[model samples]
Target: MGVTYRRILLKLSGEALMGELSYGVDPAVVHGIAEEVAELVNEGIEVAIVVGGGNIFRGMMGAAAGMERATADYIGMIATVMNAMTLQDALERIGIPTRVQTAIAMQEVAEPYIRRRAIRHLEKGRVVVFGAGSGNPFFTTDTTASLRAAEINAEVLFKATKVDGVYDSDPKKNPDAKRFKSLTYSHVLQQDLKVMDSTAIALCKDNDIPIIVFDLSVRGNIKRAVAGESIGTIVGGFCEVC
Candidate 1:
């Protein structure tokens, strides 16, 4: 089968790394994900990932308790580094050459954020995992995924979340929440749907890259998304205008 995406950016939430256990990285869960990613590599798709830090450090939680926002965000960034390292270890164990690039400049552990080097890694078929949420406070990892996708010139941004697609309401909390098979960014914005933070959708719209929202829990979903089967809500592209 022909590869649908030459290159794709996957946004994995830190919560995705948590498996059966309550907190932290679950090795089995991560290894399973790495194996699935390896299959995509074997299929010749260039993959870069941006992972969230909510599983380890919820900056919003700290801020809600009246802590300084910037300091809490820095802690959150460090949490992402920890998650990236764990995922890097799992990927390497399975023979995938992966690089963890952090925006916060942790030179001893991983490469600092450099767009040229990152693009070069993708060209060379290495998985570049971006961590640290754009190295700025008040920016969510969703926005980071869009930024990195644009910087790397990836064709699409694949956001992996607990939900299968953007819904009219929280499916977990609302039994009657309707799942959107597809959605345009304009409709998402006009209706004030929580598909993503406004900043993320705006960046993708400006850059002309689409975002695919899918449930990461479903087995082989990532591969399916990269292979161009309509697995989730597609936003911010030509089809959206159509």
Candidate 2:
């Protein structure tokens, strides 16, 4: 079947790349993700990804450890670039055309981010992977994903996570916590649900972009999400059918 959304920006946390490991990227995990993304591209869906670096280094953690805030954030950005490069390599190995665009200029590794160029890349059917978290300090990759999704005019933002969907309480902690099939941006912010940062949620709300929080651990979840299967929490807009 055809996908419901034409173009989508997938937000992947660095921790998602670590499969059965405490930290660091697992080659097999990266390859699996690449395979999923490749399937989307083959189905004629334009795909872009914004990856986080929490598994390698978290800026907030470093700041708490007495490091300079800006310096620590920069380090975190660099770590994201590394993850992006690793993902790019994996996608290319499987014969998927991909490009790594960094917010911070890294001429030797990837191209510097350019808005028009990124849109053009997607038009040409290349999966553009954005790295470096907006090239600024004090901003999380969640915000970067939101910003990029808007800039690229993506139809939806897929926030991949371990949980199947957003719950009133942590499902791991509260077995009775109800999962939301669909929610409004106002509800998420008012309840302080940890689906995405406030900034990211607000951005998507303003842009009228729908955010789907789904379980990435499931093998075919990505495809299901792109296909508009009701397998996760849909935020920003409510649909009776969803």
Candidate 3:
């Protein structure tokens, strides 16, 4: 079967790694995700991931609690690095070649993020995991995913979320919420859907990159999304929900 996208940047929230736990990563969840990603790599798909740090520590929450915003954000970035390492370990245990690149220089643990080097790693069939959230304060991991996707010229940006797709309202809170199969960048911005931050959405819109928001909790969903099986809400491009 033919795949829909040749290369993609997958965005995973730290919470996704938490599984049923209230905090920290669940080994079972990480292993499961690694298996799925390994399957994609084996299928000849170029996959790069940008993981979030909300499970370990959220910068915003720290700042609200009186920590300096920059300090809090830096801590959050370190948390992402930790998650990246954990994911790398899982992928390697399954014999999937992987690299951990961080926006911040952590030579002892991960290589400093280099666009050219990252692309080269992908060309070599190694899954590149980008960590540290752009190495900047006040920027979300979503923005990091968008920027990296454009840099790598990925065909699509896959936002792996807990939800099945983007909805008109919170699906968890409102059972009657309508899920959108497709939407325009403008509609997402105007409606404030919270699918991705405004900066991340704008970056994708500017680069003309398509964003697919799908449920990552479901096993095999990632592969289905990569195969263009119409499993989630696709944003950007000419598609519009009327």
lDDT by residue (38-146, candidate 1, tens digit) is 8988778899999999889988898999999898998998999899888888888889899999999899999999999999998888899998989999888889999
lDDT score for residue 45 of model 1: 88
True-vs-predicted CA distance for residue 73, candidate 2, Å: 0.7
Better of 1 and 2 by lDDT: 2
Winner by TM-score: 3
TM-score of 3: 0.98
Cα-based TM-score, every candidate: 0.95, 0.97, 0.98
User: lDDT by residue for model 3 over 1-242, one digit each (tens)?
Assistant: 56999899999999999998999999999999999999999999999999999999999999999999999999999999999999999999999999999999999999999999999999999999999999999999999999999999999999999899999998889989999999999899998999899999999999999999999999999999999998889998554664
Candidate 1 stretches greater than 4 Å from native? 237-242
TM-score of 2: 0.97
Which segments of candidate 2 are over 4 A away from where they belong? 239-242
Cα error, candidate 1, residue 136 (Å): 0.9
Output the lDDT of residue 208, model 3: 96
Candidate 3: worst-modelled 10 consecutive residues by lDDT: 233-242
Q: What are the Cα lDDT values of the candidates?
A: 0.88, 0.94, 0.95
